[model samples]
Target: MSNHARELAGIIMNRFDAFYRRFLDITLGAKVRFESKDWLGVQLAGRQRIRLYDHHVNETLQAVRDHMGGAPLGQEGLKALKQAFNDRLTEHANPEIAESFYNSVYRRSLRHHNIRAENLYVHGFIRRATDPDLTPYCWQYRTNTGALGDCLRQVLERLQLAVPFSDLTRDLGYVDRYLQDHGPAELRGGEIGLTFVNTLFYRNKGAYLIGRLEQGGLQWPFILPILHDDQGGLNLDTLILSKDDASILFGFARAYFMVWCPVPALLVHFLRSLLPNKADYELYTAIGCQKHGKTEFHRDFLNHLHQSRDQFELAPGIKGMVMSVFTLPSFDVVFKVIKDRFTPPKEVNHETVKAKYRLVKQHDRVGRMADTLEFTNFELPLHRISPMLLAELQQVAPSLLSIKGDTLVIRHLYSERRMTPLNIYLEHATDEAVQDAIDEYANAIKQLAAANIFPGDMLFKNFGVTRHGRVIFYDYDEIAYMTECHFRDIPKARYPEDELSAEPWYSVGPSDIFPEEFATFLLSSPRIREAFKQQHNDLFTAGYWRQLQQNIEAGCFVDVFPYRRRQRFRFLYQQGNDKPGDGASPP
Candidate 1:
């Protein structure tokens, strides 16, 4: 402590005693008969006890205004005190109990928000009369005013800043600038990190602290306690003006709190020898949150209230080994939250996000997914599809998707885009329709291959035939360029052990593929099997896909006409066999 600052603190403390004596006489009054509460030497006498507490609070503020001129404890200090008081007003376990010793203000005026009864000293403002170990008739609590006289007495003790309140909000801006200048990794290197008592949003009343931060080098293990306040995402501009003045507060608050409890940064440092590590923002928070559970472990009622069995979520995704089949009819359109990792779905790869750019040049038959949305988790983009856009499915092999803005809204599922999974729809489809669908499926594959696309998963589930008998591939998790894949022959078993092994004998990398595997996958049923064998026999060998891949890679452009031959204008009109200038045939 600097000599100059220590002298200012002493001046404030000396003046507190006289002011406390005067304030107590006013709130308690000259002639008021008290009830028989053993602790206070007299108990509280009134029915509207809560209102009287409010009255005492108002008087305390008024007294400060009367005695303490806008000098050391300016509006910022007073505001801090008020915010702390209001926080404690409603949530005290024992509102009546008070300090062990009394100067009229300590026992009669100043109120402590909470108390710990189990301790031998009964830590907090609780009087000896309320302590069972100290007194016999300690059942009913009477006093709430603890050591709160310090609010008026030692005003600038908590604030270790330049005097005269030249800049009430300078420290706040400093904290914000320090954080913005240094990333979380840099803060762990003996750097001081600042955290809010509550969040630093619009109605920010709680104080902030500057303390040393410690984080592990590996996996970035967050050593700082999960300070709900640290994640407020506020900036220096918040202290000035914000368009966000509409929403008042974010975190939970208690009932009728009146007094404030702002823990100073210096006091935090003073106790360093006993508690050396930075105040795990989560430590006091954990002690404060004995009533509820953290978000990951306890999903509250809102999670269940918004979900319905009727709603369908049709966006597709896979996280490593686990697959999220969002396009299924049984899908739930609710926003998914992934804890411990990124909360929302991250785009898996670069090409997946870039596909949208290439999609604009593709013909209509090359079905499109929802609009691509970029997320912070991955450098690529993921599809964000809306159920409302499903209305356009039949019209355009259809989908509606927006990438920007809050992508968490749940839209009502429409019937068209809610078409059953291709394999399931095939189960009840007519045999002729099944054959037509399989034929269209073959055409779609051949056309896509010619256009430099390869649907890595060639299962029936990935393709769906429209009512007009055109097959489209909607699943894109495993999609790739035709040139990037290797279509290889399944190696024959070279040793006896290979034949008996459960897995394949050949060494297969991620890009290595066997096109012959498509034959059995396409031949899942007898009718489709017979039809495919007769009509698309070439698809059974590795050579067919490889040839198509090579042709496309060699720059052989394949014209994918969307309309039928008869639907073309030239097909509808007859051309004369004569040279130019000959009259055209009538339509």
Candidate 2:
């Protein structure tokens, strides 16, 4: 390799290492933020950390340009550069991440339009699953060697949290009861041992201690949510023993976690072991590597095309006026393109739609809004798209799509995890299921509100139900911040003529919102109306929204537990104080 290529590689690696250290520095503050109750600082740190990748990428690109003395790299030069880069990764801890960083620099600096294997790392060099040197980043505990409670105690102590556990013995009893009641036979028989990731994951008010219990063939994942009490002590909020619960905690709807990961690839690998069904992109994004997650997702998508025969069709839901959505039957994601013109009653423009999505990306999702991956000039095979879907896209968003021989190119679009539209799910669901979904839908609205988001369109069609039966809002074209909205009540008509008018008698501002009118459209079905009113009648009142806005404006951070309230340890064992040895038995 030429000295320029090797020197460029060295400079890139140095920049990446600096970026990684800064990332870790921000993550390291999570514990101190939690200890000192700096909720606002935590939120700011999350937003700032998200922008670091792009900042470092731009910096690295400049450094590479200066090193090349403004000379463009030809095909041979690019190959030499790539090879030199690969050689530098022989025994590196985060080879895949560094490759992703290099790809960003190559693409942005070179103004690269096409994805070429020679110039960029379209496919990762590291085979993570089979890599022998992927060091173990977790602590192992053999339960059969000692009592389970003792092992749990040791695991808690390993975290070395700034605040002490308020009642370790009581929390242990709670964990024991959960294991006895919910665990598989292996857990009760002392056959399963625990393997905890060495780092604690911090998000919002919670610091999660995540691990998996396995004994030969049987494996069960768990997450222990550690929360700080108002006092200078910590408490075990809950014991999450189910894979479903663990997945929810790491769901796409939630904000990214801040965890110390020396080798992010190793951490992602460890998480994938616990969550075999979770995609590599999701695992990376969960651990705060969203830029790399985008790279992984592109690779996964390309691989899926080779492995499946399914064609892309219109996503199964009511058509979105501002966006056209399509999905491949065999794939778990949907691609959305902004329409050339929105339909009536949808007043948002293209830029407005993009701004709303960006707001969702920057704001705390609060586990109620699905995250989207934005892409530019994305391509798909024309033959793979169904005729109807293609026609629909042409009619709705022709300006966004173009054809180059067999390929259909989208100038800009977003890809998101597909879920069953809540309206569609409710239509086919049983009575009991409908009731459960209604409750969940209401909770989703409340949670989004508490996070300062107002889903401007609260219809069932705007929301989707994940496979885990959780309701998450996906349509972002009409979303607004709760603080920006003016919650209002419908005023009484001043005259009989006013009551008969087609439009509202009261003058409304652009930001004015009548909460009472939400029910007129959302609760049209009698069963849904009854069920929604049973648990969330307050949601229909202006006061409910106004109070939330007030709290948000006052800088109050609401606690929205990922798990069910019934699963909370404090709720489960309410009889005793945090003082241990209070003679409290498991309820």
| Model 2 C-alpha lDDT per residue in residues 1-587, reported as the tens digit of each score | 79988988899999999999999999999989988889999999999898899899999988888887888778888889889999988778789889889988888876646556668888888776554443367888776623778888888887787789778888888887777776665554645678888778999888999988887777888778988775578888888878788889999999999998878887876787677889999999988999899999999999999999989999998988888888998999989999998899888888899989988887889899999999877889999999999999888888888898999989899999999999999999988999889988988898888888889888899899999999999999888888899999999999999989999899999999998888889889988988886768888899988988888888988888888777787766676644321110121
> Any residue pairs clashing in model 2, and if so which?
none
How much lDDT does each candidate structure score? 0.35, 0.85
Off by over 4 Å in 1: 1-417, 495-497, 566-587
**What is the lDDT, from 0 to 100, of the residue 177 in candidate 2?**
77
Please write out the lDDT profile of model 1 over residues 384-478, one tens digit for every residue.
33455333232222122323343322211111122334676678889887776777677677766765667667777766544344566655556
| Model 1 superposed RMSD (Cα) | 30.8
Model 1, CA-based lDDT: 0.35
